[model samples]
Target: MKITGDQQLIKKMNKTIVLDTIRQRQPLSRADISAAIGLNKATVSSLVSELIDSHLVTEMGPGESSGGRKPTLLHFNRSAGYAVGIDIRVNDLLAVLVDLEGHVLQEKTVPLADFTPEHVLEQIRKTIRQFSKKLPESPYGIVGIGIGVPGLVDDKSRVVSAPNLDWNQVDLYESLASEFGPNLHIDNEANAGAIGEKLYGAGREAQNLIYLSIGIGIGSGIIVGGELYRGTSNFSGEVGHMTVAENGPLCRCGNRGCWETLASEKALLDRAAKLWSDSHLDLEEIIQLARGGEPRAVQLLDEIGARLGVGLANLVNILNPELIVIGNRLSLAGDLLQDAMLRTIENRSLSYHRKKSGVAFANLGIRSTALGAASMPITMFLSEPDPALAQEGSPSAGL
Candidate 1:
């Protein structure tokens, strides 16, 4: 059946187009926006005015004169709003508050010895409050909060299960909403990491990319055609559980030798435990040792990288992504691990697959998850402003 567009919907679509045009081709004039968005000059002017009024866009006086006259140029006001993002893992929480342009305004990492839901939630709330206390004035203040959980998250952002953390049926989003308000989002840590890399890190230019979050456990986030592909059950990229060794040690998920059990940070630490009984030697220390030419450290990292490459080869053979970004704590291993990973990929994957996919370490480093999480709010504000915020008398009602 055919349907007609509502006047409001048409207006919103036009506004989005105009805003996107300005964002993509900034320092543009009315004529430029009109031509780029295919909107009439008058309509473009009205939308630009609305955007300016919303503090989402700004006028930069004038641009280089055409044959006729100089025109006022427009710029996207990235600092007009703010967002909060957090990455919750089994052992720690990383949180950041960022402006609309993806610059971190504030950040903190808290180690966790307790994995209880209440304890985790309290830590998150505390961090958010600390961030809120320092929020600078903006059109939108903490517009939304996005959290990345290292687990199976449903479409509604509920944690179905996180075997590593032993969490099941946890309503993280709902639990935080009462204190943080309605504008909260949650997703799998890998999925968040993928978008993080795509938006701000190594995968920025890659439309089809895979982000492998190799922390305590490995999780993947698939980006297809510049969009995240959340499967029917939102469990599409749980590649950690993909069995690689039939007789290998049993995984937390009851699987035998899942890829993560062999390649993840936990795996490295486990192997290192045999040589160095010091519990204080972190992944970073191990990587430093490997880089320093320590024989045992180098050998352990090679094994980890090879296992990681095996799983990556499986992904490359099937998906053929343009890039595969390895992030999370294990990424700290740097070239010491990546060289071995590339060698294994070259040996294990088909020539076609090996040549097509480029493996890279995450450029965003540890901030990937927090930045990506914060982007959710920035995205929502830019793409769809809250009606309440736009209403009269709201703090963010006017630019």
Candidate 2:
């Protein structure tokens, strides 16, 4: 019997669903998946068989059975392929090679002395080559690459603007697609961080959450109903540009009173510079000083935390997210900033809103963006009906 297009599509989708189920609840019998997803045992078995043929799922020894013969358990083949995730920061680029399960196999931090697009692109290419050289043997080596840019990435994966990197209208997808195949994703760094936290970190259990990347600038990734909510122009979470203080300091965006100018790590360093003119104290040094009970450093953190809280309270009042994850460089100062930040939120946000909202630092530390970025290509590759198509530009394919 010839299958129609609709039937083929449905079969492909069902196969994908089965693979996802196995990945999420691995080491489970085929019967468990059929029961869990309400599919018939025959259909589940067929899909699982297809997944196994595609090398995306594997079968283990028989498991204990409630009745009759024991059932063999199925597991997602995490080592079937690999992906590269890159997070472009103002001063450095963080790259990670991760398995299909988002497990980091290798990681590298490349310092960026130049913010020019050409230079950064070269660095990215070099890093990917290095990762390819060190990759472990797998069926689909280096399936694809995902990049988190510290700027506005359009729907077409174009870097519309990255103030920190001095980039505008940079088409990274076009630059890398020739060598990496079509499965490339470029998104705002904060958006990537939000996804990272949602899938594997602090926001895992919360459907609605916000990931705030507070480093040189404060950016946010808003997850509504477990999905990133990109605005009309794919520039939804520019919270740093929100005006908090009417006559506050100037921002790199040529705006006064922007939230980042007062709440971001840059803001903290700026204030610290004024207080300790003789010492060039970075965020780490200031945090260390605060930890050692330095009165001035403590006060400086308190002020920055209060400012951060002001913006956070506004976010809570407006979005009412279940959780707020603070990430990036500023999160390293979480210990010193918690009290004053919470206090400001308590005084500012609506009581009802604050009650349901919990604020926490990123559980993945500074690797949130990198891991999240890596997951994108893996997701795209796994979603393909034919796994071979996903391996077109992989290193194992001689690309």
Candidate 3:
């Protein structure tokens, strides 16, 4: 029978649904998929056949049947494609090569001595090439690349401002697209972290969660209803700039008493510097000191934790998220910060609002942004009806 345009679209969507079902509940038979998604046996078999032909699904040996003949089980082909995720951190870049399932195949950390966009771009290119060299055999080699930038990324994937990187109005998409092709994504690092946590880390079960990236400066990724809440200008979640203190310390953004100025990793370091004018201590050293039961270090971390709780309390009252995940550098001191942070939140936040909220540290450690960034491209690549579109370098697709 000749298929109409709408019929073809429907078929493509069904095929996608079939692939997703297999990915989510693998090692299931066609009858199982049909029953799970309410599709007919014939339609499910047809879509699964197309997926198998496309190298996205593989058939395994028959599974035990209730009384009749055994059924052939299907599995999603995770090794069919690969993606690259990069996190452009303040001091370095964290890059990872991941399979379709978001498992890291290779990981690298490149230090950044120069913050210039040109230099950073070169390092990114070099890192991708290194990853490509070590790539495993796959049908779709390097399906796409996703980058998480430490700045305000506009809807068009332009870096509007990143104070830590000294970047403003940088068009990373344009620069990288030529060599990398069309399947690319650039977003704020915190947004990427939120996605990472939601998909594979602490926020996996929470439909509404906030991922706070507390580092040199505070930033956040707010997930509302299981999706990142990008504001009207795609510049939401700049929680660091929120005014918490009327007469607080000066912030790099030219504001007084912004939340980051009082509660971020920099804030902790600034206070530590003042206490130990004779010695220089990084975050790791300070955390070690606190762990060793040092009075001053413990007190300092407690103070930072309380300050962090102030902002978190505000977030809790406003967003009422199911979970709040603290990530990035400050999260390394989660143990040291938990007591004071929770105490302050208990004291300050609305009792009703804080009751259902649970706070936790990042489960993926520092790789949240990198893995999340990588997942973006993988998602886009998989949503396409034709896998050849990725191979042929077609325009961007979405999940």
Task: Report the lDDT tens digits of candidate 3 across residue range 195-235.
Answer: 99999899989999999998899999999998999999999
Off by over 4 Å in 3: 1-3, 394-399
Supply candidate 3's per-residue lDDT for 109. 97
TM-score, per-candidate, Cα-based = 0.94, 0.98, 0.97
TM-score of 1: 0.94
Total residue pair clashes for candidate 2: 0
Q: In candidate 2, list every pair of residues with a backbone clash.
A: none
For each candidate, what is the lDDT?
A: 0.84, 0.92, 0.92
For each candidate, how many residue pairs have backbone atoms clashing (under 3 Å)?
Answer: 0, 0, 0
The segments of candidate 2 whose C-alpha lies over 4 angstroms from its true place after superposition are 1-3, 395-399
Residue 206, candidate 2: C-alpha displacement in angstroms: 0.7
- Itemize residue pairs with steric clashes in candidate 3: none
Error of 3 at 92 (Å): 0.4
- Supply candidate 2's per-residue lDDT for 398: 47
Model 2 alpha-carbon miss at residue 29, Å? 1.0
Summarize candidate 1's per-residue lDDT along 289-369 as a digit string, tens digits: 888999988999999888888998899898999999989988878688887788888888899877878999999987787
**Candidate 2 lDDT by residue in tens digits, 1-399:** 356888989888988888888889889999999999989999999888888888889998899989889999998889998999999999999999999989898999999999899899999999999998988988788988899999999999999999888888999999888877888899999999999999989999999999999999999999999889999999999999999988888888888999999999888888888999998999889999999999999999999999999999999999999999999999999999999999999999999988999999999999999999999988889889889976777644545
